[model samples]
Target: MQNDLVSIITPSYNSEKFIAKTIESIINQTCENWEMIIVDDCSPDNSNEIIENYMQKEKRIKLIKLKKNSGPAIARNMAIEQAKGRFIAFLDADDIWLPEKLEKQLLFMKENDLSFTYSAYRLIDEEDNDLGVFIPPVLADYSSLLKTNFIGCLTAIYDTNKIGKMYMPNILKRQDYGLWLKILKQIKSTKGITEPLAIYRIRKNSVSSNKLKAAMYQWKIYREVEKLNIFQSMYYFMNYAYYGLKKY
Candidate 1:
C-alpha cells in the first residue's frame, strides 16, 4: 500500500446531475495525495461521460465500469480490492467535502495515532439548500454502534496499516453500517470531530428515507449479518428505532 495516500471509493448510478460537482469537490481539496476511484454501476445516464471528461484532465480520477448493475456494496468492494493507498475513505456521487476536510482529518488521525475516524456533516436538499448540521458522538465502539450507525460513510476514514483491510458484507442495504461495525470489532473505538466536514444531500426518494424499510434492513443486519440472537437483535433494534427516528 502507498503510505500516506488516501484512496477514495465512490459509486455512481444515474448520478449525472451531481457527479461533476462531486469530482470538482475532490479536485479543490487542500490535500493533493489522493486518487478517486469511481465505479459506474451500469449507469444508463451521462454519469460516465462526465467522469470521462474529468479524467482527460485529472489523472488521479479513475473509473471502473461494471458489466452488470451491481449494488453499491459490490462497487465499493471492487474499489477496495484495487486500492493502492494505506488510507481509505468513501464518498458518494452526490456528497461534497469541505476544502480542509482531508488536510485537517489526516492531521487529526496522525497526531493522535488513530486508526478509524469520522466527522460531523451538514445536510443539503436536492437543490443545495442547507437543511441543518449533524454532530455524531465524539467516540464510539462496537457495542455503541450496534444501537445505531453514527458514521457517515462520506466522512469516514480507516488506516490499513493498523487493522489490515476490512470489507463490507454483500448486502443490498446498510452495507456502510456493516463495514463500520466490522472495523469497530477490531479497534477499541472510532473517533470523530464535532466540526462539520462534509455535505450530505438528502433526496426525497432515497431508500434510507423509507423509515419502515430501513428498520427492516437494520434488523436483518443485526440478526443475519452479525449473527445476533433474537433477544439481542430485539434489544439493539429498539435502540436503533429510537435514535433512527431522531435522525434528519
Candidate 2:
C-alpha cells in the first residue's frame, strides 16, 4: 500500500469549532499520500473560511462549497464523485484520527488483501474529552451488519479499485450504514482492526444524540431501502437495540 493515494471525504456543516483539529489530525498522520476533500454543505458559520485557511497551507486538502444546503450524504457523494484514489476513507469534520491510523490500516488491508475494513474508536464529547468508552471491533459480514452497524464512519476505509466507487443512500441519518451494507454485499466480509484509531465526537443536540429519530431512520433503511420483510426487520432491530445498549 506504499505510495497509494487515499481519498479522505469530510462533510462539513457549521463545524467551525472543531474542523481545525480534524485537519490537524490528518496532517499529523504518518501516511503522507492522501487527498482530503472537505465538502462544505452551505455552512452558515465560518466553516468555509477555516477550511480555506487549511487549504491554503496544504495543497493536498481541497474544498468543495455547495451552493445549497444539502445533507451529509449529498456532500459526501460530491467528494466520492471527484475521488481519484485507490482507497476511499470517511472522516467527518468533527472527528479525529491518530497519527498511525492511515498507515496501519493500509498495511492491514494490504496484508489481508481485504476490500473493506474498519477499526475501533473512542467516543468523545464536544470538548474532545474522552468519555472512557471505546467501541470494540467486530468482523462483520452483510448479515451481521444488518443486525447492527459496528463500523464507525470515522474509522472505515474501503478499496474503490475492488468494489468501485459506492455512494451513500440519500438519507438524513444512517447513510454510512447504507454504504457499508452496499460494499459488504459485494465483498466477503469487512475485517476489523481491534485498536482504537479514531475519535468520534458526540455533540449534544446533534442528530446522533436523538435516539428516537435514529431508530426511525434505521426502520426506514430496513423497510424502504433494504426492503426487508417485517419479521426480518424486527429481528435485526432487536439485535441493533441490544448491541447499542451494550456499547454504552
Best by lDDT: 1
Which residue ranges in model 1 land beyond 4 Å of their true spot? none
- What tens-digit string does per-residue lDDT give for candidate 1 at 132-214? 99899999999999998888999999999998988989999889999999898888686899899999998888866688888
Give the TM-score of each candidate.
0.98, 0.96
lDDT of each: 0.92, 0.90
Point out the worst 10-residue segment of candidate 1 by lDDT. Answer: 206-215
Positional deviation of 244 in candidate 1, in angstroms?
2.0
Best by TM-score: 1
| Residue 82 lDDT in candidate 1 | 88
Query: Cα RMSD to native, each candidate?
Result: 1.2, 1.4
Q: What TM-score number comes out for model 2?
A: 0.96
Instruction: Look at candidate 2 and give me any clashing residue pairs.
Output: none
